[model samples]
Target: MKARTDTKEKIMELGTDLVESIGYPSLSYQQISSQLGIKNAAVHYHFPSKESLGLEILNTAIGSFEKMISNISSLGLWEQLDTFFKSYRKHLESNNKICLIGASASDYQELPESMQAAASEYLVLVKGWFVELLREGREEGVFHFKGEPKHKAAVIVSALAGGLQHARLVGNLHYDEIVEQLVEDLKP
Candidate 1:
């Protein structure tokens, strides 16, 4: 049972990387199976279908987002904002900035219904978290953006998502500059 669970997790992790880099249409059971040193039948045993595997990958992303939110619960407003910003930087610096959600969102029409719904849910949740963070940060004078918190949140989310793609092309230093500009722009 433990081995089965471990193999399932390995599939999800590798599947996530494949999907993030190549998008859903390019991901396949054979790729995951070959990469993980397993048979396609084993992959199918766990996921049963490509749609199931795609849904699992999205669900994994949702779980990671939830964990990120929970991990920052004790932080003050400024620190929380810093942590949020740093999450993207961490990914960039690690050279893992290619985002599964970004790829999923881009390939939305190609996805199964379950995967589409899950991807949408992840975006909505992330945007909602940013809205709350920006709202509270403004109330406490931690952020100085002029506009509705929801609007700023949307802008930030879109910028970071777009910035992630741009970084993959223009390089990390440029990406860091964009993030620094965002931080400076929000200063009171």
Candidate 2:
């Protein structure tokens, strides 16, 4: 029983790394199996399909983001925003990979319906988190943005996600400048 659980986890972990480094469309049970020294049939037994594994990866990322959001409630408005920026930077710097949803979005039309829905849900989750944070920041007089919190949230999320991609290509120093300017512009 423990061995079964361990194998499943190994598949999930390596699947996620592959998807993040490459992309969902390029991932395969064969690749995972080769990396883990397991037969491709073993991966099939656990995941059944690529879409199933992709969905699980999306859910795991979403769950982790949700926990991060929950923990930020105790932080100051500026601190919360800064923390978000730093987290995004950390993700890119550590792995040189874009956020899973962002990477999946590039091949969104090619993805299975279930995987597409999971990616959409992940975007909505991040946008919703930003909306709440922006609204709180406004109420607290820490944010001086001129638009609706929802709109502002969309811009911020887009900028960070897009910026990560740009940074991946150009270099982290340039990305840092752009992000620093973004955070600066949001100040009251």
Candidate 3:
């Protein structure tokens, strides 16, 4: 049982890496099996289909982001925003990859219905977190932006996702500068 769990986890981890490095449509069971030195049948035994693997990957990424947000929930508004930017920078600098949902979105139409729904849910989860944070920041006089918190949250989320893709081309330093400007603009 432990071995089976480990194999399943290995598949998910490598699958995620492949999807992030490339894209979901390009990830193959053969690639995962080759990387893990396992038969393709083993991969099939665990995932059975690409849709299943994609759904699991989306869920794992979403859960991970939720945990990160929860962990920083008690921090001051400014600190929470700082940590959020830093979290994105961490991924950008380390992997040069956009968020899983962002990457999946490029191939959204090609993905299975379940995977598409999972990706949509992931975006909602992140956007909802940002809305709450922006509202809190506004109430605390820490954020000064023109529209409703919901609209502002959407802009922030879109900017970060766009910035990550841009960063992959122009470099993380440029991305940092963009985020810094965003933070400054948010200041009350």
How badly does each model clash, as a count of residue pairs?
Answer: 0, 0, 0
Q: Tell me the RMSD of model 1 versus the true structure.
A: 1.4
Higher lDDT: candidate 1 or 2?
A: 2
* lDDT by residue (tens digit), candidate 1, 2-74: 9999999999888877887778999999999999999999999999999999998888888888998899968
Indicate the worst ten consecutive residues by lDDT in candidate 3: 86-95
lDDT tens digits, residue span 11-47, model 2? 9999888887788889988899999999999999889
lDDT of 3 by residue, 16-37 (tens): 8888778899999999999999
**How high is the CA lDDT of each candidate model?**
0.84, 0.86, 0.88
**By descending lDDT, how would the candidates be arranged?**
3, 2, 1
Report the number of the highest-lDDT candidate: 3
Report model 1's TM-score to 2 decimal places: 0.94
| Model 3 segments more than 4 A misplaced | none
RMSD of each: 1.4, 1.3, 1.2
Q: Estimate each model's TM-score.
A: 0.94, 0.94, 0.95
Model 2 TM-score, all chains together: 0.94
Q: Any residue pairs clashing in model 2, and if so which? A: none
